[model samples]
Target: MIQKTLYLLLFFSSFSFSQFDDLDLTPADSLMQEGKIKDAIIEFETNYQKGNRDTNYLYNYACALAEDSQFDKSFAILRESLDLEIKLNPLFDPDFLNLRTDKRWNSFEDELISKIELEYKTIIVDKEYAKKLWKMRALDQAYYFQIHLAERKIGKNTTVVNTLWKVKNNINKENLEKLEKLIQQKGFPKKSLVGNNAVQAAFLIIQHADLQTQKKYVSTIEDLCKKKEADSQSFAYLYDRIEISEGRPQKYGTQVKYNKENQQYELYPLVDKEKVDFWRKEIGLSPINEYLSGYGIKI
Candidate 1:
């Protein structure tokens, strides 16, 4: 009976470890949905420590940290998530769009972009291998390569732009022109699409056109942004324009904001009373309007 009980105990122990092996992101996700950010952070940290470092868990952890008003910690976690995603599957990683503007986020993105370019160059040079593997890997690589380029343009990462331009110079002029147009049409100047890199590529075809042409493309973007029709790129663009533009940028809290009184950017806490005191005491500025001086209200 003792031996049998020991065997059962060992089995259950192993089973429990296996169950938690991948850092089940569900609890953190649920807590986030319920606005239990501190609790979610604790759960996510537990999972992260268990080596379940998937992108979703990392993202959720970062989100939880942000919701708890820990901006620097959240950004750090986001950087980790971006790096892991790039390393695991550059072809399908959707974390890039989330971290474009973050200074720390850019370094990892640049590294991945560089690696993809190098890989692409090597593939192009190996004609014999390319011919053999073209059916299997060529389309996938091409698709990802195009996506990386599109992301660079949207993020206004000048190095990426120059690299993409060089790559474009090597491709057919018609294709390059198409890409340019798409960039203008999709407002690549404003945002990065996380998942649907292909749609961003399509948008690159007309991203920099005249006003009338841009207006024409807005409908196309609207179509892309529709829930039924939306992929990551479309949803990302829409999220930036609508949600992020409103206060979702602060959803994962940030310190930087334009101070209308001081006419300078200031880092203030999410807590209203502290933020009010920060403006008045730290900056020596009087509140012009009480209505505009709180959470979700950007100066």
Candidate 2:
């Protein structure tokens, strides 16, 4: 179970991204998640037309095309995604299973891997630490893919869900301990020191940590953001996480609560609903609506 999760979820975390500053495609993402392939394609194309060229968005668009058995179209989009420097590995992604049967798949896969390797070669510092951070990220998200399955197969309050959370909590605690020690030794990994992917992993470890840990490192993250060493979206999410944890309304609507009764997601309280986008724009984040749409969430 753990190995499967790692393989399947690894692509989602393998690359740290800067392209997320573009418009959000949550509506399309939600449609794809529900297997509404045609709707998702339409939504994705609309977002693409509107200038949402983020590699993650393109990857999902390609997946929707593949799910619809539009291999040629999907491959074209995958090529476009590669041009955008997508870090996802299609070999392990179940969404591209159908594409594997195509004669063009092997060559495309080789090209994709080669390009990914070429990009990785650009990481001049902390290569080993970056690899370690990627593994940490893999562990951080490894069990999340099973939570919904557990909830559906049994129930949210069942031992299955409890065990998943317990395991994830343990992983988070362990990652946090390692991260703090790294910070003490290396003074927080930045892009120049450890490359963007590793820095992103470090940020994610802190983001997944407990409230006290977040509070302790929030200023450090903010400092990194100010120096342009970290992505503002990271700080935005962490800021909202800290706010929501402290019982204060979030400023950027980056935090959401899953309403299991409705089987939907809803944003946490916002500090100012009207000016939220302004605040988000100030920090290089997408508007709250665009951000919420990715989660199928509404204001």
Candidate 3:
């Protein structure tokens, strides 16, 4: 019974972690981008009233309210966010500046600090230090995607080639070295040794590694999944990467290119076009249409 309870907590925490982080800007998000704070607040606050639980939406709604000088109401919404245990750091946010003059701000920040400590304690759910390394790699993967996406955007502004990508590339290389040493000393950080979520993070980072680097760990990754140490999702992604690199069509349509003008995603070559969905289903992936929905591609 105790073991079952721990598994339940781990599952819930991992699910919440994944759900909140996979965010893309919505219409309300665009409103915030365009500085239409009131309109954005109206849209976000309406969702909140209907019991929307997305942390980004809640925090942005609070910020929009603050921008509209709705200090008291913003405080109310922010407090609700605290009940959700969302990561709200007051110091870095300019939106909360006006509320800082109020005495309530001090107490609110203290409550936040306590929650933040508790949150970390929860994330460190696994006893193995490999979970910590995987978390670092997960962060690196996220940062890598952000840098890559931002660099892609820089081209539209007619700037000299984006230099930050070079810096980020260097950082990735450094992380690669760190991971290499870790793998040599400890072997592939199988999700079985840590928590499933930690191995999920590890697989995510492995996806971002160079093709040769991926090749080195592919067998171990496959072996672990066979033993129930890792899930098939990352294996599908990693195998697809290898297939494409070797000049073969990928069984999984994990690779895609976006056509900005048409707002559609063009899938990479498939080993068997008609059988693509079959392979995806076998590996526990959603159908291509469902997967591409997040990219704003039309089905």
Candidate 4:
């Protein structure tokens, strides 16, 4: 119950992302969740063929084919994904376990990541720190979000929080130092100057930082957002989280707290509850009711 709530919260957390951000998955993912594997495979393959070999579509198509027991076809699909320069998940996904016994698995796995590095190498013209920060911040999010799901068969739920925290912390320190200098030398790290991805990376680093750290540049980020340089959605989301963590009410209803006894995540107190939906709409967030449907929330 608590675990399910965590998953729901995680799902809703994406509400804070930019409206223009690429969705990680699609409705076809629900077909897989519903155990209609064949339907999912067909949909994934259709999407892959329709797009310009969108690696996301390609990767999922490969996973679905493997689950359907078509190893040869699956491997072929994965090769297309690699050629598309898809970033591979390091921890082997269970969907590909069946293909792991093949002798070629080791080399294919190595080559997949090598190709991702090659792709990164191509992003060095300008805002190179943006690309570097983007990769680090995204990996940090994955590690933080996957913590609850990491468990052993011994029934003990384990975590890699410390390990992930160390990595995130070091990167955050570097980002903070660079950002402070950037603010003094120029203005805030904005799209015209630092590039869009770097600004996004800056917001991501601040989101995971402690309150005192976030406070140091909250106004600077907000100013950039007003200039239409940084993202307003990200700014509001970070502010809401920081306020909630400090026992203050959230303005956007973007944060929630788990109710252990009820086995759910209830909305955290809001500063102006009636205005939340209005603000959410202005920022392109879905209606709260629609967003909370996964948790069986009505109000």
Candidate 5:
């Protein structure tokens, strides 16, 4: 019974989508992004009343309320969120800065963290390993965004952008070394070992590694995906990467490249253009057109 309960918790916590992915929240999100906080709250409330009561919606609604200084309503919505998702670290969110001043904030934070700890302690076999992976994931992504920022603000070929790429490559190399050692010693941290996020983080490290490293782990990833131990989307990304590296048309169409001549992003060569959407759906990915749209590539 305990094993089943832990499995259930891991499944739900691992798969809860974010607000950005929830189409129903888009109107409120657009309003929030446009600095119309009160209007965003009203739109969010409208969605909630219409039965769009997912975890992401609730959390973002609470954030919108908190941003508008509606602390009591935000607190109530957040308390509702606790029952919907195993959200972590409510105490540190900038959106809840106003909530922090209220006397009830301390108890609310304690209750939130305590609930998460209770659930995580059951499923995460090695808390320290999970923490380490979280840090590694942060470092893995930190430089990429900075490199993009540098490319946009500074010239793409300028010293600042070049230096950022060099730094990022060095960090990737260091992260890969650590990840290889961890995989060697611990044998690919599965969901049960370090929790879902850590497992995904470890996979991201592998994804950033050289083609050979990605190839080395491809079969293992396939096995994990088959067993529901790892995310299928991660497997799709790695598979597409390997195919592109091997000079073959990708099967899932997850690989994209920037067209220097056209100033647009385009999908990589696919094994079968006509059936790419079918292949993507087989692996839990969206249609190729929809997926590439996120990269500014229209069908």
Candidate 6:
């Protein structure tokens, strides 16, 4: 009887291990790495439905979807992954920037950011209470909030940009000073309140009152971006935006030019026929140019 019981337990354990081993994601990852995006998506979706919806599986699904150009679905899943565990290590994840332009992405990001801000507010309300509870919750929320904010800023999302600006506007001088001091000493800005407001409070430091105040936070953003392997287009877009903001002409593709005199950016064709065809296809302007003409560019 004892021998039979032991055998049964071993069989069950092995069965469990086999189940996980079968969905190890290595094969799907290889497909992704090899740029066989469609195959990877099918593999990942199959396993994800069969296995536990953990961060890794969700991330893989999101990545495969993005690679397959299913931007909306990919963004949704990535946000779901973040929601499961609010904190994530962006240094190791490359899916954030890939979904930047998806309309649904920003609303989800804002919701998460709001939650992070709330968590931060909780800390400020009572330091002792925060010290006890914040660490447990902070890891997920902080990491998520931090990475999301960084990505949005780099992606030049005007809504997020305005939100950060608003946060800075609301912070008082005394709290700002304290937060600055805390950041200098502890490497992260101190929150004056805990809860959803905490992220807003922290944003004050990043936005800063002046260029001198922004120096430290700017360095932090630079460091974070450097640590991650971001998409080339996203990186180039950020680089060009920074240059343009600093009164320099963006030196990228010949398709676009910044006109300092008019304070407007204009798109000029490198190859007139090819560019016209590309624009037409992009905006569905091929069959009817009039409908898209109101979109500010002529194909």
lDDT by residue for model 2 over 226-266, one digit each (tens)? 99887777788788878887899988877766688999877
Cα lDDT computed for each candidate against the true fold? 0.41, 0.68, 0.60, 0.60, 0.69, 0.43
Best by TM-score: 5
Model 5 steric clash pairs: none
lDDT of 1 by residue, 178-276 (tens): 444544554332212322333433433332223344455556565555533333333322322333233544211223346789676444333354355
Ranking by TM-score: 5, 2, 3, 4, 6, 1
Residue 189: error of model 5 in Å?
1.2
TM-score of each: 0.31, 0.61, 0.58, 0.57, 0.63, 0.33
Q: After superposition, how far is residue 136 of candidate 4 from its true place, in Å?
A: 2.4
Between candidates 1 and 2, name the one with more favorable lDDT: 2
* Ranking of predictions according to lDDT: 5, 2, 3, 4, 6, 1
Tens digit of lDDT per residue, candidate 6, span 1-299? 01001111111010100011223436676565444679878887887778758776676677668646698778777777767766422211323344544676556545654565475442245443333222222221222222234444465366665564444344334445656666565545223333322333344333323435544455454443354311222223233344444566543321244478987645533224444445344423232244224234454
Clashes of 2: 2
Model 6 scores worst on lDDT over the 10 consecutive residues at: 9-18
**Least accurate 10 contiguous residues by lDDT in model 3:** 1-10
**Local error of candidate 5 at 229, Å?**
1.0
Determine the C-alpha RMSD for candidate 6 after optimal superposition of all C-alphas. Answer: 20.6
| Model 1 spans with C-alpha error above 4 angstroms | 1-25, 66-71, 87-108, 116-215, 218-299
Q: Return whichever of 2 and 6 wins on lDDT.
A: 2
* True-structure RMSD, every candidate: 20.7, 9.7, 9.8, 9.4, 9.1, 20.6
Candidate 4 local Cα displacement, residue 99, angstroms = 20
> Model 5, stretches more than 4 Å misplaced?
1-114, 117-122, 296-299
Off by over 4 Å in 3: 1-131, 142-161, 259-264, 292-299
